[model samples]
Target: MEVFVEPQEGSPFCIRIGCSDTVLEIKAKIEKHRGIPVYRQTLVFDNETLDDELDVEGCNILDGSRVWLIVAPEPPQSAKIELCVGTLPSVMRLPIEVQVNDPVKRLREVVRSLEDVSLERVKLYADGTELEDGRRICDYELQDNSSVDVRIKPPKFMVMVLPWKADLKVAVEVKQLDKVKVLRKELEKLQPSLELDLPSEGYFFIHNQSGMDEDKSFQWHGVEMGDTIEVFRGTISR
Candidate 1:
């Protein structure tokens, strides 16, 4: 089968190979034909990353299917890297090219200029890990063409979750980004005896004096660090 290979910054090429050929084999072919090193190549098919162990058929790559081969800039010794930045539910990514030795503060400045958000508000996460402002990009082990999650920090306030029926009040800290579903799952782990009947419709957040409101986010309903919210399962019928 013949497949189209599109590099990040080069002309697309076609390679002839068998259906059972592994991605590593294809990378080797690319290295031999195009003089691109296999270590610096990051392959993507149908918007998903292709692993070295996966064969052509396993990736659902058919004949004439175009695969992305994101190659690092040459000079082999250069510390340049291409970074992708975006939020969730959106595959769109803004490409950022910078040196690996560059401090995160400089990168944050660039992001702030491009995104029009304050440097303090923008946070970059890569590989499920948050990037620290004091460290260099290389210190985080970010290679060429890496994906980074760019999120603007919203106003955060802590809230305490307490059992509504019981007198027990555990002052557990809560963040604004905490989801109701995730909290319920954690609560279930902490207290297996309590039958938390959280409904699919939504859960309720009730303050001692404020009463009940089915607000999705804790911050939306004016929940603060010292404020204690009673946990009550939603009574919606399935």
Candidate 2:
């Protein structure tokens, strides 16, 4: 019978085994193909972990069945570390459990995906020094419970002149630390020259942009520098 085995962190493949093949036998096949030792291999099916001595027949593992394989993680040479992710606008703190051997780029990818921030904007720092993506977590020599700050670079804010008499729009270089109210104030000063009226209560919103709360900074909105903020009249709706 052919069985499908998927690794926890690597590629998945199919292997052929007889009905009487033991779990250890399956581990041996995986070890041959993936180089993970049989002793380190763990197999689970239907949410139940299978014992090493269990055979395919006893486990009731049929052909075309899928098995989840988790190879034991490498021991940490140093102490286990915790990563704290801080993203702008919301100033969210995400605590992540990580091993020393994990790649720094992997953590960056996680933050980038979670915050919806661009790869260039995602910055990881340990101590006062910036952490490079190509390095490993161990390279930082971070102690247990050490906080890693995830800062985002400021995206450019494009203020689209609403009631726009012209096709052109004005672009503003804004920092992630800058608030939406400040952005609106800047627009109020600039819009007069374009015959655009930005009322004292005027606010900015980007259509289809998630988390466009005017009270929050651009970083919180996951907005890119080139993205436009639609001009809205009156106060911002909650």
Candidate 3:
């Protein structure tokens, strides 16, 4: 039977070995075939990333199974979620709503600091309630009906000075696991919204590169108040 493998971009051929070959042997061979080593190349079976150091002894293989070796982007799933940024943020309070496709996360509450230049923070809450001083969004899950408020705090000096002049809002969106997986591709075409005026303060259209919202890209050209949203079939080259 013929086996299908996900070919890395620009690679000539995919490495195919017998069922008896261990993952180690496969890696060694792939390194020989390609310029990269087994350790460097990420191996994925059915979209699940495989650990390179682990032995292939317990990894049962079948005849038609496919293993792809690609120069993958960093942690594909997390990037998938954050790439939806500039769009509305999902709610992430505790006792969160559960969904079948909810990306399983160890997130709880976030006391965001709009106070600093670098948005990076350490991971605070792992189980839900506890807080790690400087953590990242990757650590948290945005649950349905849960509002993730990025509280903006003012900068502090050496002494205790009251903080003021910081404007922030509790930006929120509903999170449903099942809803996310369905947004894996781009929309063939977007539906035009009713002739409505998108206020400069309330709205700016996000690019529908991932087909998540099925909304088309917003063009600033000729767009004015009381104009209708134009829907088109947007395509990506790469």
Candidate 1 has its poorest 10 consecutive residues by lDDT at: 195-204
Report residue 79 deviation for candidate 2 (angstroms): 7.7
lDDT of 3 by residue, 43-155 (tens): 67756666543444345545566777676333333333321111123443333333312232223221222223333431233333432332233324433333333332222
| lDDT tens digits, residue span 93-179, model 1 | 988999876778888888888878677888888887777675568756687778988787764354567765666665554576465
Q: Which of 2 and 3 is the better model by lDDT?
A: 2
In angstroms, how far off is 7's CA in candidate 3? 3.2
What does the lDDT read for residue 122 in candidate 3? 19
* Root-mean-square deviation of every model: 11.1, 17.1, 20.9
Clash pairs detected, candidate 1: none
Model 2 spans > 4 angstroms off: 1-80, 88-92, 156-238
Better TM-score candidate (1, 2)? 1
What TM-score against the true fold does each predicted structure earn? Answer: 0.35, 0.34, 0.25
The Cα error of candidate 1 at residue 65, in Å, is 55
Q: Judging by TM-score against the true structure, name the best candidate.
A: 1
